[model samples]
Target: MYDIYSNAREDSWRFTLGKCGKRKLLTIGLNPSTATKEKSDPTVARVQKVALNNGFDGFVMLNLYPVRATDYRTLPSKVDEEAFSENIQKIEDLIRSEKDPVIWAAWGESITYHSFFRRALTEIISRLTLLDVSWVRFGEMTASGHPRHPSRLAYSWSFSPLDMEGYAHSLRP
Candidate 1:
């Protein structure tokens, strides 16, 4: 839809991407990469494969942060309050109306990458708490209990249920 659902023309940040269907899989990564509506990076391609293979009509790519950095290690140590606020708002708009929305907690180990990342996820989960959202995980949760990222695997696996709210609360320093 619209090549891909995105908020800006620049690549520094991506609030949302992917085409929405009546039933779509919403994937949340740590941050955005170089992919756009015109092209897909490895991770986005992997997401599309997982969604379609598992019978979803479409997929929506979201992130804990919108900032685009190829290497997450390069992400700012300090959080940008405005960007964080807008990110939460955009996420609400994307998922608020869906009936029984299935969210893929694909952030994996990145949840522990920084306190800001964990904080961002908690805010998003707060909004989803009121809705009938079911969180799913693609493969295995890491040793630390975080869902695995799509880009980490080569084969698609059927999603397993994840205790999203509980998982979010467990993200302690």
Candidate 2:
């Protein structure tokens, strides 16, 4: 197991590298919740299971909320600038060491909305010059227009891989 940040809660994320060793995929999540720890993040687990089921294992997991635990509604203000920077550096280094066309998956909306995850991605994009990446927004459709349930909002969204190819291709100058 890699030495992940100490502050990160257990089961916040999990990584499974592809067995072929040719391609790499990264999955990032909004934060750790009671449900995530208990079930190993069903949404992510489903994806990882699918990858393994299909014979691919190059998957890496990251928790957007590395330092403090907070729900989606409380995320905007709970941002830790320093931790965010450190995590970004770590991710950038990881990407730099890997080959081209890295596949990245953001587990949910909060992961993308939170400054920690967003800034880290921004930094990775600017520093490492990543070629291929994907952002998957999962489980969000469940609560599209419904009144935000305080307890269920975090777990509502199902995993859906959003396109990062076109965005990465557009990045080339």
Candidate 3:
């Protein structure tokens, strides 16, 4: 098993490249959790299961913030601007490298917890739109109006391209 946090240092970003297949997926989430000895976080496992069921052989996981905290509420109040910028660049590079992957908008409702995180998400979504990458909305949206997170997705479901225009308009400037 590959360790996602192998190179991680205190307060630094960390990510794992999941199993690969012919049909590719890119998932953007809030942040990673500390993976234990055997299994990954339930959220990660949920994403993998859905991808495989939807005919996506593999997935590459990224995050809005790469800091490894179990919950967004536990994150530090101050956002690391430099790390956030670098992580965004890394995600963009990965998207550019992949061949028209189905990018899953799986950040869930965590965006509401912090203004800085929401802003970062909006910026990333804008970049995705500019690049013409597809956004996959899984199942129904939450009460907050964002797409359902992987863990919250319907047991049997499919993904569709999100309405980026309307979504962008909804974001506070």
Predictions in order: lDDT: 0.82, 0.45, 0.73
TM-score winner between candidates 1 and 2: 1
* Best first by TM-score, ranked: 1, 3, 2
TM value for model 1: 0.93
Winning candidate number (lDDT)? 1
Q: Model 3: residues >4 Å from true position, as ranges?
A: 2-7, 10-12, 36-39
Q: Which consecutive 10 residues in model 1 have the weakest lDDT in total?
A: 1-10
The worst-scoring run of ten residues by lDDT in candidate 3 lies at 1-10
TM-score per candidate, in order?
0.93, 0.54, 0.87
Please, what are the lDDT tens digits per residue for candidate 3 over residues 70-90?
A: 778998889888767877777
Model 2 lDDT vs. the true structure? Answer: 0.45
lDDT of 2 by residue, 1-173 (tens): 22222334243332222223455455455554433322444444554554454344555555444443445655556666666666666666655666653343443334335445555555556764434544444334333321111233344344455445354343333
Q: Write the per-residue lDDT of candidate 1 for residues 2-34, one digit (tens) a residue.
A: 245665535567888897677888888899888
Name every residue pair that clashes in candidate 3. none
16, model 3: CA deviation in Å?
Answer: 4.1
